[model samples]
Target: MDKIIYAILISNDRQDELTRLLSGIRGISDSNLFNITYNDISVVASDFSSNKIIVDKEFAIDYARVIEDLAQHFTLLPVRFGTLMESPDAINEILIKYYDEFKQNLQKVENKYEFSLKVLWDYEKCSGKIRLKTESEDQNAAKLFHNNSVSTEYLLKKIKEHRFESALLEHVEQLIGEISTRLAQLNPIHKFQKMVTPNIILDAVFLLEKHKKDEFIQAIDHLKSQHDDLNFLLTGPWPPYNFVEITLK
Candidate 1:
């Protein structure tokens, strides 16, 4: 039977306590949970038949639940779902090989959690507003080239389209800058994606100290109040999923 790896955590010489905790929580397929240790770090795992696994919503949820439960008690690096080792010896070898990398990551995430924020707006309405502003500020290109040939008219249309796109991108960038500036006080490690969808203008994740969770939420609320035209959806205090950068071999 293969062992399904859930997370790597700092045991800190608490093996007996960890064993008691794992005894109360079940792994996928109700398998017993156990840990394979290397010095002060450990990998929480369970016996699993690789062939018996089914990739489905239920399985994914169960897997996440296990990690979430462990996270409440320990600082852990969540292994990718479905990670399996052929035997305990192989698992031990991995723990040995990646020990330094694992320790570094674990220390970085200790006492921290992650949060996500999505800024959304009505794309059509926002674009229309920008178009109106652009046209009002500059003479209509179609009117300026009314007497020109068809080729000239097409070129003018393209130019207008380009200007509109540029303006929209500038607007999004300004918003991102403002968000970063406002949240800088919290000193979170953050990642931002612009224009995740037509409506979702910004998608961001932040790794913050656990003690700062409330202040972070308050900061987001303050930002939301300032942007009446934008919708801010902020979630979490979850395990530092986005902050983990290690790739296990």
Candidate 2:
């Protein structure tokens, strides 16, 4: 049977503790959750049968939920959705092979958690503002166009488009800058992606000490109150999915 892996946990209590935890929990397909240990590390897994309950997106998320539940009491590296092996020995070998790297990663996230902040803008409203700001310039440029000067028409048209895009991007950058400036004070490491969607102006992920969670939420609340024009969805004291940087061989 193939083995389905859940997470790699750091437990000084080692084999006995892992076995006890596995015994308390269950795996997919109602398979008994088991643990494979290497020194101080343990990966929670179970023997997966061929007629196995295949893991789909919902199931993967459910699996993540289980790991998240466990993370409350354990320091672990959440395996990305689908990490599997053939035997308990292989899982043990993996733990031995990747032990140091896993420990380093776990250490970083030991007492911290992750949060997601997605700021969505009303695209039509923002575009309307851009249009209003450029209306006169667009009108003036349109008047300069003639049938004889195709080059002028092309240049003018390009310039209008350039102006519109530049204005839009500038607005986006300004908003992102404000949020980044505020978040920087928290000293939480962050990843900021801009213009992910026409409506999504900024999607940011932050890794912060668990104790700072309230402060982070308050910061977001203040931003929301200040920018009622846009919507902010703040989710998570999530397992540090975004914070995990280690990759297993």
Candidate 3:
């Protein structure tokens, strides 16, 4: 059978114990979950019938769940949702090929975990409030209504709308900047996605020291004080999903 690789884990040469533990779990489609170990690292996997296609989201999430279970007992590098190999030998070859890179990555993330932070806001509410703040400037522009021709009025309205949009964008950037400054103090290695949309203003992931979990939370709470307009959604001390650095063919 073909195989789908889920993650790479640190085993410290304990392949026998790792195998014993893996024997109890099931992978996708009720297939057996297994591993491809080399020295102190192993790639967790499952039987994947190459011809029987199942690329749906529910199955993919099930795949993630399998990795999540193993991660509870080991530090691992999670592969992107669908990473398949032809056989155990192939995975073993991959382990050797990427051994140094994997070791370095493991070293970098040792005794640490990942956390995600997202901030959502009420689109209409925030936009309306922002419009009110800049309305004075807009009102002045509106009062400069010179030519009463249809095209002239349309152009003026368009200009006013563009100005309001620029104002909204600037306000959002300021919020992101403030959050970034606060997170920087936490000294975390992170990847941040900001201004994804008007409603989803920030989506960030932090690779933080395990012991600093509380400090990270405290930082968020303190940061929240300055922005009452946005909603903060923070998830994870997740197993380094965004921090993994190696790949398998």
lDDT of 3 by residue, 1-249 (tens): 788988888999677878888888888888888877788898898888857866898798788888888877888888888887888999898899989999899888888879999998888998998889877887778667776889878987888898889998898889889998988997899998877876898899999989899999989988888778778988887888888866444
| Model 2, span 90-189: residue lDDT tens | 8877888888899899898888888999999999999889978987778887776666487887888898998898889998899888888887888898
Residue 94, candidate 1: how far off, in angstroms?
0.9
Query: Candidate 1, residue 75: CA error in Å?
Result: 0.4
Give the lowest summed-lDDT range of ten residues in model 1: 137-146
- The TM-score measured for candidate 1 stands at 0.94
Deviation in Å, model 3, residue 172 alpha carbon: 1.2
Any residue pairs clashing in model 3, and if so which? none
**Model 3's lDDT to the true fold?**
0.85
Rank order by TM-score, top first? 1, 2, 3
User: lDDT by residue for model 1 over 1-249, one digit each (tens)?
Assistant: 888999999998889989999999999989899999999999999999867878789998999999999999999999988888989999999999989999999999999998999999999999899988777544666666657788887888787888888899999899889989999999999999999898999999999999999999999899999999999999987777788888864
Please report the candidate that would top lDDT against the real structure.
1
Candidate 2 accuracy as lDDT: 0.82
